[model samples]
Target chain A: MDEKVLLTGNIAAAEGALYAGCRHYFGYPITPQSDVVEYFSAKLPQMGGEFVQSESECTSINMLYGAAACGIRAMTSTSSPGFSLMQEGISHIAAAELPCVIMHVQRGGPGSGSTQTAQMDYNQVVKGGGHGEYRLIVLAPDSVQEIFDFVQLGFYLAEKYRNPALVLTDAIIGQMKEDVELRTIDFGPTPEDRSWALKIHRSPKGKSANVHSAVGIVGIYNEWLARTNEKYENIKRDEVRFQSMFMEDAELAIVAYGSSGRAAKGACKLAREEGLKVGVLRPITLWPFPQPQIEELASRVKKILVVEDNLGQMVEDVRGAVEGRAEVHFMGVFSRHMPDCNGMIFPDTILEEVKKLL
Target chain B: MSGEDERKLICDTPDCINNTLLPTCPGCLHGVVARCVCEAIDDLGIQENAIGVVGVGCHAMTAGAVEVDTISTAHGRAPGVATGIKRAYYGEAIVFTFQGDGDLGAIGLGDVLNAVNRGEKLTTIFFNNAGYGNTGGQMGPTTIEGQVTTTSPYGRDPAQSGFPLHMAEMMASLRGCAYSARVGINNLKNYAGARKAVKAAFQKQMDNIGYGFVEFLCTCPPGWKKKPDEAFHWMEKAMMEEYQLGEFKNVDEIT
Candidate 1:
């Protein structure tokens, strides 16, 4: 059973790492989420896990690359610019089909943007965020409890599919304090299972001839890409996770994720009080996003408003899934002239748009 | 050198291709250096525990040949990658990065320095062939004195280009590395030294002593626009002047 306790979103994520059997934590300390490192540094070794203060974000993710290659669960957590440095390594893992988890608690920016929170990296996270044809199983957990649960589920899906996984939160979710249950889930693989990892070629059973190489060359990569593409298709077709509130026969379907998801709840509730016949679809897993369901809902609802911090990134995905079945309006406060990271898209800003659209 | 001396050296003759794959240009010096690393891994009987971090440049092609657990890293960050791999699974595998001059010296200087300074328990093999061959020929950070390439059209202007960097020696100054040595791929004496460095790097990794480095000052005849024999002769006389061979640091002796 998960015990109810208050935690900063960063600490909640650290606890999730422990519960999920992810014993290796490799990352450099960055702002707005340093408590994750601080919490895991003390807690991991206590549980006989390994925690490393790597030289940089690049080294941390690459370290995850090594650990995950051996089929062991591994992860790294970072903020904006550090996440930027980690993209190259993330690309390598994605190509290799190595299962590693990354948490990006977005602060603001194109450079060393800000230590404060914002949901600006939706495009970077959901669209592979690196070079080549790849996608992470991006999970958006709005609540502190969901943050803990998805960190574990993210590891399971990553290992099952042999792909990189992501838990995306902004400062809002990463730093929030709320009651969460610390339930133990038996993930069934210890860090010791990765004996060969990057160093040796061994399955848990013992000595076996290992192939260090994976998809990179043309013929080989094509075969792997075919397999990866199938997996991508499966995720889109099979996994469509979301939470619904008053969605039945709703005339307006408001879609959001992460902080916006929380904000949309309030918006939908207000619209309901006014009897405007509105409902909300808040996606828990952001990638292979809940598109088909949104399409189904779009047929009944006249308009779908995509409320996000950045300018209309996810609206395109919603529009593509619906394919002109209905009109999709974007309630985005996009400060394109300034920069993606520094702008603000307040919950009220989205609420005001909802008022006008209805 | 006589034919008898050539027999003793471990060269990458076409007769000696073991795997159906390899990681260097046809007849480039990197083939010899790679074979030495392979031999060291074989001799230690750690192929099962070996992870090779292949980087861009000539070594990018090496990802296919290496039999051990391998991951191709971005340019110049092989050491950083290997450091993570090895540390997260201590005693589980032998981790090393294989890199060339353009990838290591030109663009990725920070990665090497930081890895060395951190004393990460890993091995690094640097193939320092003076000019860039993967792309169009250009003067690399380890380009020899008075050498001509695509970038330096009128021969390397030492007055403007400055002398080449002696990387192992520079790394030795950090005082955190376990072993540091520079060798060559041109001849028997230099080949032996290079192999010895390769072996030492592996041994240090097994011992958990600390960071280790082996620099192979190789030759690129096709890019340099010369016959293989002439390239070796050039490396013999002047390459040594700019980038010296022999041990820069021996941590075992200190301990």
Candidate 2:
């Protein structure tokens, strides 16, 4: 039986991880996402799971690395600054091919920008914040229910690919409460033969299982690099997820994600009532971006308005996807409902931008 | 004795040591500490159930030589990683961290202190060669006052660079540490003490007492600009004065 409960995005994320068999949680408390650590700390021990309030975000990510190396599902949640601190560990985890989930409850940034909501981490997360040639499976959720669902999906995809997955959210969605139906989501069987993961028992090959990031041997390193690149390509091909609405007979498509997507969706509904052919294309997977759908939409529509809570980050991807097939416009953080620090994108403001573009 | 028996006695390598890997530097004591660790695992008869979290440095290569299942963590993160491993196993596995002076005393100080403060049942083997051995002999947190290295051209000015850290003593002061000791393997007597310290540290973890730490004042001949025998003499004569041997903290219970 499934149970429905009103949950904030943070609580929903925690529940989703638990339901996904993530028995180890290592994280440090940070604003807008502390609820996740709090919930895990209170719930994990009772369930015979492990919860570690790590000393820092750096430590937290390394702990996640350790647990993941042990072939167990582990996760950590942090905000912008803390996420920045985790980049080194994330890079190592990726190189080591350890599967883990990281949730970034983004806020304004550049440097301690604001504790309020913003999508400023678009380039940082989607474009690869850490060094080296690597990509994270980025999931952007617009609502509390989606937050819960995406977190579970994140873990599944991480384990399936032996790579790290990121659930990209924001302060508004993280702090807001909504009715969430909690249920186990099965993404089919992951690789059962985890011979690569560290086990206490000696390997049958008469050698210890060593999990490491650096491959010094040139031949082995080349093989590893080839395999990792192929895995990324496979993920991109198989896991491009997005939600399209009212695009069947539309001329203008509003491309957005996360809370911005939520606002743009409301704007699309309002635009339809006013006899406008506006539609919404909300990307769920930011890295495996829905470029094919966007390209298809561009062929039909004359104009595409990309709305975001930052300075036109995702617009670059949209423009690239459209490839001059349509005129792409952007509504950024400056076009919010208010001019104050707590300003957010609202349906009315987005609709106004849509009307001007049309 | 029979020829086969003599050969067996002469080449008695621990089952936990991977014999294929090339040896460490000429006078580096990482090999000594690695043998001591493997010997401890063998003594406890937990070779199959032991896991190691190795931090980055020259000491990281030692993980390749030690045949236990190991995870090579980011520099200075072995404590955090070991904590995760120990917690995931719920003390069913014997988890330990192999780290260097720079890895532990500098970059990973907070992680080690926090792990010990949490009373996580894990063992830590810290090899302090007084400088960053892997990165070409740069000055490290444990580099002694007035010591000269590549980074410390003239000397380690206490005003410019802080005095050497007493990591084992500092760790012992923590309320969560069950056992903390500093030892060396420059001589036969000290080698025995080092083995005993390593075993005691692991025993504390096995008994679920709390965190166990053993710091080894190791020799880094190339990094210290000395020959193998000279490095051993320097460690015994100079390093020993600052980093005294013997256990700083040992208790049966948390209180």
Candidate 3:
């Protein structure tokens, strides 16, 4: 049964993960993401699951790795600094091809910058944040409901590919409350049943599971590269997801994702009322990025405006996706590694940029 | 050949050693340590139910020879991994960690301490070979004063490198630790005691006792830049002098 309720993005994500069959939750407290840890800590145990308040983000990620290696559905959540500490474990889990979900509620930083919401981690989440050639199935959710919904999808993609999945949201989306419809989903087989997981039910005759990253083995890495590359190519071909509005006959396409995309939706309506024919293209998956849809819009639209809260990170990918098919303009507001209460891209601000291009 | 003598060759029951040839350099104590651990698991009759979490360095190779379900953890993260495994399968499986001094003492001290403090029911077999054997004898936390290593070619200075950490003594101080012992493997006499200590550590975990640890003062011939026989003599003379072989904590006294 689906029930309607008011929930914050952080709470929604936790509830969604629970419904998706995440039985093990491990995390350390980080601002903007602490609600997730708190929620899971209380709720998971009540539901006959396990929760561990880890000593550090490094420990939490490795705990998730250990649980996932045994084919258990596990997760961990963090903000920037804590998430940064998890990179080493993430690399190990990826190399071992374990399935797990990690949530990073974006914060401002090169170091311990701010606990405020920001979209600066686009590269860190989509590209490999850790060492070696690895890819995480990254989902960017704009609304509280989507944040709830995408967690289930994140786990699915992780298990589907036997790799890690990340739910990348920022402070605004994570903290903001909204009415959401929560539905319980049935989770699939444990990864251990598929013959790759570390067999938990050990018998004398069963084969022992050998899981390692082989981080610097040149010969072994080539084989890993070939297999991972093929999987990523298939993901690129099948998983590129985007949503567009007012694109039916618009002359300009506004590109954004997550909260910025929500702001762009409002800007598109404002531009259309002023007879500017602006449309919005919001990407749902940051990696396997909505390239083909951007290509289609590039052919139809005369110009593209890419807006973000970061100092022009995703615009590079947008430009590459467009590939000179249209003139791409980047409109990003840079912050001083501090929280931006009003630094988020607003509808008026994006409209102003679109009007300038018009 | 007498028929009675031919019938004396019998191999049965506790198939302790793996069929594969020992995969260690000649005269390395890693082989001896591996044999002792496998023998302990066999002696306890928990080989089928045991799970091994192995750390990096030469100790990582021990997993291949271990007949149990084994997972090689990241360098210095075996205790953390073992903690997760033990918690996930709590009271269902026997979990153990095989780690070297560099993996347990240097970068991974926190993981071991926290797990022990939480009183995780797992056995830890610590190999204090004094230096990082896999990385060509670099200085480690257990590297003794006045000892020569790749990073401390001028000999380990108490001022520069800090005093060698006695992990068995440190772990013994923790209230959560049910048992902690330091044993050496140099002479035939010490080997017998070392086997007893290893067996006791495993038996404690089997009894659902908390956080048992056995620190083995083993030899690294190449790391020490000595011949096999010379390494044994040095272990007897210097290493044993610094790391006393005795049980520091027993469950009957601690808990």
Candidate 4:
């Protein structure tokens, strides 16, 4: 049997990062996500890694840039306001084309609304929060196991694309304890052998004279844009991941991601027992949108229900994917009235919505 | 060594220095400061292993000037970036940050102070040209009283813009800081001191001592709206008086 233990999403993320060969962790303490830093602070040193509790999110993200440029696996985590502060550094990281993982255990937003779970940062994370034209390979995880798994996958994708990747989870999954089987997956060869990485030499006379900057004269910037656009196109074509359940003969489809996806799965089961022909299409990668698969599901289903812990954020993506082939209804809930889990659209509520469509 | 060879050897400019004219305004002290720091790196023979973090400002364009590996970071976040590099590489990479007053003394104050406080073994060369140089002479945290700029057309009033910060003194007071100094780059005498300070900062990092800071009183003629030659004189007469030049603290003294 595999080694399994009850771990919170944050701890699983830390363990996953360690197993993924992350040697540096720079982070600022933030609510609902501070355990990631706490775990790394104690575990990293024992594992012969480095951990820094930075002064702010701005500093921590820049630290991520530095470590990533050295061709080392580095990571950081934060929540709403802290994530806002980190946008500038994230833009710099994207422009410089360095690979690193960033986690956002989302809370209520627009401002520091609350420390409870909320998915208001959907557009901010997937639509390039910083500046300029860029895209993060955003992986939305629904469970403690997915949190653990996505951490390693995030690093792999980050290194593979030479871009920053994010594990976008909300407070419910970040704090919830679940059984996770710890395992290691090999990511083949590291891409740091490229000429852009920093390394020690006897003199600055070799291929190691790397410069990691995004700003330059107009001509240089134009060239950079072309190159980055091409990389994003490849990611869109190759890196999209999602899971479909009971969609082959379903009359209704529920579109959800992250923790909302988990709830929608339960809702689907309840609807099935009640003999409603309902299913779920859970997107694991939010940025690429799983458009083709959603298009197929939309053709087969009579209606689509988009569920989220925020006010219709991912619903837009679902709509775009469905392309009006199916009638898409939004069951949007914001994390304002109660804690994240209670505030969310429960499985029973989702089952009721599915029955209505039926 | 022959006289010519000896002279050549004494010229410690690292090959990493972009031989092309610096992207800075003509007669700007940033060129001199860059040369001095590069020379220091060359002298220490850490050019191969050195990694620099270039802050966003006028210094952003200098990324290509150095042969060493460099990362151009967001404004005022170079110290944090360098801290990450040093932590990642630990003793293998000698990391440093080159930042200006606007980037360092103002926006980056908290990160730099905290990095120093945390005892990160790295080097920081702060270019204090008083006003924001690249941003068209805006007032900064280090803009001295009575110094006139676009933002301070009627002369800098301490009552309004507040006082200029003494970064070296503040850093030296921090427990994690191993070496802190304020140096001027106006003349040969002060220039020599600045060079030594830059070298010493790198040495401290290489020795795994702690955070080392050297604040240079750089001249920004365009920002000051003065001619280059006149700006040098102003830096000597006014800037020197307010920002005292010398090593504020040394690890040897502490030991």
The candidate maximizing lDDT is 2
Q: 3 or 4, which is superior by lDDT?
A: 4
Q: Which segments of candidate 4 are over 4 A away from where they belong? A: A190-192, A216-219, A334-342, B1-16, B253-255
Separately for all candidates shown, the number of backbone clashes (residues 3 or more apart, or on different chains) is: 4, 0, 0, 1
Model 4 chain A lowest lDDT segment of ten: A334-343
| Candidate 1 local Cα displacement, residue B217, angstroms | 1.7
TM-score of chain A of each: 0.89, 0.97, 0.94, 0.95
- Ranking under lDDT, best-scoring first? 2, 4, 3, 1
List, residue by residue over A1-93, the lDDT tens digit for candidate 2. Answer: 589999999999999899998889998988879989999999999999989998899999988888888888889999999999999998888
lDDT string for model 4 (B129-227, tens) is 898888899998888898778889988898887899999999999988889999987668977888899889888887888889999888888888899
Residue B1 error, candidate 4, Å: 25
Q: Predictions ranked by DockQ, top down?
A: 4, 2, 3, 1
| Candidate 4 docking class | medium
Better of 1 and 3 by DockQ: 3
Clashing pairs in 2: none
lDDT of each: 0.77, 0.89, 0.84, 0.85
- Judged by TM-score, which candidate is best? 2
Task: Point out where model 2 deviates above 4 Å.
Answer: A203-205, A216-219, B1-11
Q: Can you write out model 1's per-residue Cα lDDT over B140-192, one digit (the tens) per residue?
A: 88887677889888878779898787889887887668888998867777677
Better of 1 and 2 by lDDT: 2
* lDDT-superior candidate, 1 or 4: 4
Query: Candidate 4, residues A1-358: lDDT per residue as tens digits?
Result: 7799999998999998988888799998999899888999999888899989988898899889888888888999999889999899898888888899999899887787878777889999988888887889999999999999999999999989899999999888999999999998876765646577776664555654455665454128778988998999999999889998998789999999988899999999988888888889999999877988888888888899988888788888778878888899988674224445446657888787777778
**Which scores better on TM-score, 2 or 3?**
2
- For candidate 2, give fnat to 2 decimals: 0.74
Instruction: State TM-scores per candidate.
Output: 0.89, 0.97, 0.94, 0.95
